[model samples]
Target: MTSEPTHAEASQTGTLRGSIGVAGIVFLVIAAAAPLTAIGGALPVMIATGNGAGAPMAYIVAGVVLLVFSVGYAAMSRHMVDTGAFYSYVHKGLGRSMGLGAAALALLTYTAIQAAVYGLAASTLRDLVVEYGGPDIDWWAWALGLIAIVAVLGYRSIDLGAKVLAVLLVLEVGIILALSVAVFARGGAAGIDVVSFTPASFFSGSPGIALMFAIASFIGFEATAIYGEEARNPKRTVPIATYVAVIVIGVVYAVSSWAVVLAYGSADVAAAATADTAGLTFGAAALFMGDTASDIMLIMLVTSLFASLLAFHNAISRYVFALARQGVGPRSLARTHTRHGSPHRGSLFQTLSAVIVVGAFAIAGSDPVLELFTWMSGLATVSILVLMILTGVAIVAFFARSDVDKRWWHTRIAPVLGCIGLIVITGLVVDNFALLVGGSSVLATLLLVLVVLVFIAGVLISKLSAGKEVDRSEHEESRT
Candidate 1:
């Protein structure tokens, strides 16, 4: 019985051997998260609600900060080879206990974000459907249908899902870029001004609120390491993916936000955000393209959100499978598919997590989007940031003592700076968690405590099992 798993595991590893190339990894970085890009939705809204024209600058601040964090993260990936992502990175950098804690955070954060995306997808689907005079399909129903689709895709080879995501991600970036460029070409509201993104705009939010959302929007960029096991060449591929993803996501945010700010003129930003439906980007769209053009953008926004949800579904599932493979979750979750070579056992639970999240929101008498945006998404951001900080720590530690070959830049100083940057950003965001969810810190504290507790327990268990392996290895050398 055990022999079969050992062979299947070997085979699973072998199947994705050379398949996912640099382009595939890049697609993974850009997936689902593109729609949630800070410039397109949050920043423009932030301009009116708090930041002013400086909202675009807020993204610049966040981007530079994250790029700093990536210095260490990518450096660590050069040495630590594991699909376990943060869990493994932290373990090698810190220890089993710390790694476990990171793992727990990974599970909660990934699953929460995955469920959160469902709520977003549902709301967008609901509105889009209603626009055509279709019956009001309940949000949960739409969420479940999407969850099912994600479950299926996640059950097969990762490349299958990657292909679909590449197409969707391309379309998402293309559509948003087209609209932003259209705004730029149409001109007039402010006539193509670069001053709108000046450094001073970073302070427009209530102290740190703009930074919180800015960092949150960049949450998925670090997921490049999550594909190490399936990537074509783990050592080289992961680092390139990590860097490319960060730059791409950052550039897109900067350009897109500047386009919006330019179209509307920074002066009218706050006024537009506070008005009736109050998210200024749409107003900017209408300002340049008329009501019909803005409406089309809204429709495209809806599609972008859906693609984002599906993208996240795949991410969270792999995270689940990673934890399970390490004996953190049920043993069955450690199993892999013989034919498709995906985390089939884990895929079953992907939608199952959505079911529970939906049921929880339904029981709480809250809207899914509210739950998604407020609770799950915020927690996910916190968790991933924590992982980034931990990854930086790991990179430093691994380079400090690892017998493996490494460079001084990849291992030492860069990672140290990355650690410092991530810790700072983490502190900033965690400090402003209440704002991210648009709720009281009191409630946010309780939620954070609950989530952290789960992460801690995962850490404890993993530490104890560090030297133990329930599934005996077929290869005597043993693998990461």
Candidate 2:
């Protein structure tokens, strides 16, 4: 038998360099969640159109479900360390065809979400510029410019991107937490309503939609495992990072959202949100803190979106690299930069794809926030939930046949419970798909159909690609 490749050899070729610690990985994962963007953007929408005052409860419920999912997910990370993450886990348990399908869905999930964020980020930036007396410009121009900057950052060493994200994450999260504290300290609008957590309120006004949006906010937390290969001592680092990131995201979102409800009082919050969905969070900041605090939050919102774009860019590029390395994509995409040790080819590919998608939306004169962000983000939310369910099942299957670390909680119980919860959430998403995508049933149906077709196409590609299984086996062995 031939000798295994050295660390240096692997780094110079197929394997990503290990440079990040647990904190770095956590930064990347949490930054992708974009606390400010989720609170200031998605939270108001959830309050207005979802479960209203009970919106905070929805976030708590979503967090608990994902925490259970992460138990088994972290266990799996101890055994396998690869950038493929969900694709590799599903492949190990469900077989190559299902693995490829999961991979394709993941690609769609990340790509579409990134594009969605770009739409919002571009629009937000355009508005900010005009508010500050800058020259008027199209949203697409701002989007393209942001994409170019992300491309440069993504094309560099992974640590550089992590550092940038760490700073942005700290600032946005700090402002949000500060705002939440101020609201509570001032006794809020109605003395901190605990009724928001009541079952009656929680189940009111379409809880399914509320849950869907809450869960969507947690999308980027699973990305912890995606950075495993680049993490120092991944077996330890990945698991710790995963748990920490999940808890932090869940807490930040839940507390901040609850604070927003307190700022407006539980009774009138929904109406206020409906009246001014875009400005609801800003208004809360202005009321609880000061006008200066609100202005700072507006600036932080842009940075939060920028940080999210960079995080997702890194994630999508790595997925492309992983697939290419597995012989499921172009081999060139597998190549890393010799100097930067980053997935340069994959980064360039993702950049171009974003440009093309955004260009098409612009040329068609689609509304960035309404059409591009809503539809694409809605599609991503559903697709990712489905992937999570599949991954939970795959974890159970993989552990059933293997003797490695046979803890029942980590290997079976948690995964099964998480799977069941995910199934329910997925069903909810499907039931409210039209509402999630701006009340367009036709568009919702088409998007759902597209998800199914993309998965089927992936399965077909796996069968058609010669030597794919062999390539996957060798790749896994090398990493192990």
Candidate 3:
């Protein structure tokens, strides 16, 4: 029998001294999902412009599709543990070329999502502060300050980020659940309408768009695998966190949205949402719980967005570290901190990128909510869907060739189905791309082209680097 691998061999590419368990991983993923922000910010827009009362069903549907995706995802995690999760998986299953492409795509998607939240967070904070009689500061100023804070947290140990996210997640979930309970006690205007669950309503107008938005809320759940290197018994921790995060996000979103619909009459939710797009959740809470509840929710929304920004920041840093370790990017980024055991180099780079992107928008005098937040979020949504589709394909390819576990469903059936589902969703997003960004068709097409170009660039860079390495090896052999 082979002896156990050395510590260095076991950790092929060094990571932090990770002791994170399932709970810490769950908190990170769920914090990225940002339940309070989704319910308070995105849900109202979905209800008003999407399938109205059917929005809750969209969350459930998206959750089910992702659960199928997770079956193979978890199965693969048992053998492969890399911080660049999507990239590494694809590299092992497909090829190095495709793996590098996935790395670029993952990096882009995470950065874009994090930037989107900064825009929203800064704008929300600006309004909240101004309303409370504080001096008016530009949204970008607030964004910059928050970015500095996130950079600091992300430059430390993973456990510190986990702990901070845990507190924020609890507060966000607590506020929303309290509102749901209040709604239950008071009974909504329609008094427990079952129509929200009816197929006719669920599949009504604009359901595809509703589904797209629903999928965005689950973005962080896929990231559970990204933390595999930091997890205790990653084989178990990753899968359990993946399933738990998805179910919690889906149920909380579904139940809270349904309660909101019930709080207002199902027939009137769309109109009510349209009238007070940003205030829908707060208004509902105030209706049942009192004015104080709405006030608390407003505060929680700001903190929720902050938690999400921090989560995404950590994810991007790890992806950068993973790629650098694999020789797919700048060599310096692979270095981890001696004291903190964190990828501080990557964290610093990511922070710098955030400042540049946010600063560009600030200098242009654009609307933080409409232009910065909306455009970045739209880009992230499309890019992430593409990554998920590629990952699903990678899972199928990886399992079909390897027989580590040899389970039929995990190896063959589930991954194929998940890929099909993602393919359909990708098509839907493409059809409604303009709606997603509130932009013209030309702009949407350009953004899509940019994503393609990024993937191609990564492939070309990887091929060239491999060629150079081969030449150097041959030269050394000739000298010998």
Candidate 4:
């Protein structure tokens, strides 16, 4: 009789293979953040509806908070290096139940964000096609087409995805930086006022709302650890990529938002944004670099969205792979392609999930940006903030129990501070949830409740699955 394969043997067969370095991991993380999409899309709305000229300061504030969070996060990565990332780290620190809970939340967070991007990407692509005299296709058709493309890329080698993201990220950042340089070189509309950075300006209008959006833009920075298994010298590369991704995203967002404020003049930016929320960034680009540049920026915007979709697709698939490997999800999802070494099963599942969600939205005749994008993105923002707070707590807990690396600042103080900051941000997200979703309070409440329900379900599932055998020996081997 043939012997049953042990979990260890099965895990070894499904292991991901790669040598992704710091830059490649950074490319994946930053691409998910989608700088151009944030600037052209989120920033204008933040200015008009949130903090006005003080929006740049909001990005700076959010960055500092996350930077503090990363201190403890980096320390934890050194010891618990796994592609499970937030899930694995939370599990290491908090125990099996909470880890499972975090894993579920992580899945929800990435999936929602990916679906949200699909909505926006579809809408943006539709508009671009019609503007250039292409067929006026439905947004869902474009979304399904993009999903198919992302599924293909994600099903290949991790390095291929990283390479594609690198090129797209460079182009996205290049155009945004060029536009910023032109604005600053011209000394802005009224000579580059410094008032936007003031404490008073930072508190102007709805600062909480502004901070929420700012924090949302930094969503993918923490994903550095998700590529740890594929990364070369992961103990060092993961931490370095984490810090670099955070700083790069922060500086780019703060500088670009500041430049936009300068382009319209501090006193007038709010009015300009309010008048033309969708066109605010494009208008500035046109004013500084000509209409041709603006058109290019439009094209880049669509690519930026595509890059984000691919990045998030990779992330969610890995999450599924990690969970399945640990016996928490379907065992089939843990399998990798023999040739590509990619989590092809997990990728297929994510692709199908996107299809169902996007298809439902289309059948409902929902507005892509207003309903699908706004609601799902808002849901993701809150879910991620909650996960960060949990991760911060878990980091402190893990260090407390283990004598691994007991630097007071890294293990205790920083994690505590990060948790506090994240908690405050979570409160902001809760209070302004309605505005964030662009919907009624009832809808916001329902969405927030959905996050809570998912966590509880994960915890319950963990309890029920306690008897399932999980081979963590492979993860331990990686650490060794």
Q: Predicted candidate 3: what Cα RMSD to the true structure?
A: 4.0
lDDT of 3 by residue, 1-480 (tens): 989976644443467657889999999999999999889988998898889999899999888998898899888988988888888888888899998888888888988889999999999999999999998999999999999999999999999999999999999999899988888787788688777788998888788888889898888776788888888889889988888988888999999999999889899999999999889989999898889889989989999999999999999999899888888678778878766778888999999999999999999998999988888888888888888888888888887777787898988899888888888888888888898888579888988897898889888988998999999999999999
- Which stretches of candidate 1 lie above 4 Å from their native place? 1-18, 205-207, 276-279, 290-292, 403-406, 463-480
Question: Order of candidates by lDDT, top first?
Answer: 4, 2, 3, 1
- Point out the worst 10-residue segment of candidate 1 by lDDT: 9-18
What clash pairs does model 3 have?
A: none
Question: Which of 3 and 4 is the better model by TM-score?
Answer: 3
- Candidate 3 off by > 4 Å: 1-13
- Which ten-residue region of model 2 has the weakest summed lDDT? 5-14
Model 1, range 177-199, lDDT digits (tens) per residue? Answer: 77687887878476777665766
lDDT of 1: 0.72
- How far is each candidate from the true structure, as Cα RMSD in Å? 4.1, 4.3, 4.0, 4.4
* Better model by TM-score: candidate 2 vs candidate 3: 3
Model 1 residue 57 CA deviation in Å: 1.4
| Tens-place lDDT digits, model 2, residues 409-441 | 999999999999999999999999999899989
Tens-digit lDDT string for candidate 4 (367-406): 9999999999999999999899989999999999999997
List the candidates' TM-scores in order.
0.90, 0.95, 0.96, 0.95
Off by over 4 Å in 4: 1-12, 467-480
TM-score of 2: 0.95
Q: Rank the candidates by TM-score, best first.
A: 3, 4, 2, 1
Q: Which candidate do you rate higher for lDDT, 1 or 4?
A: 4
Please count the clashing residue pairs in each candidate, in the order shown.
5, 0, 0, 0
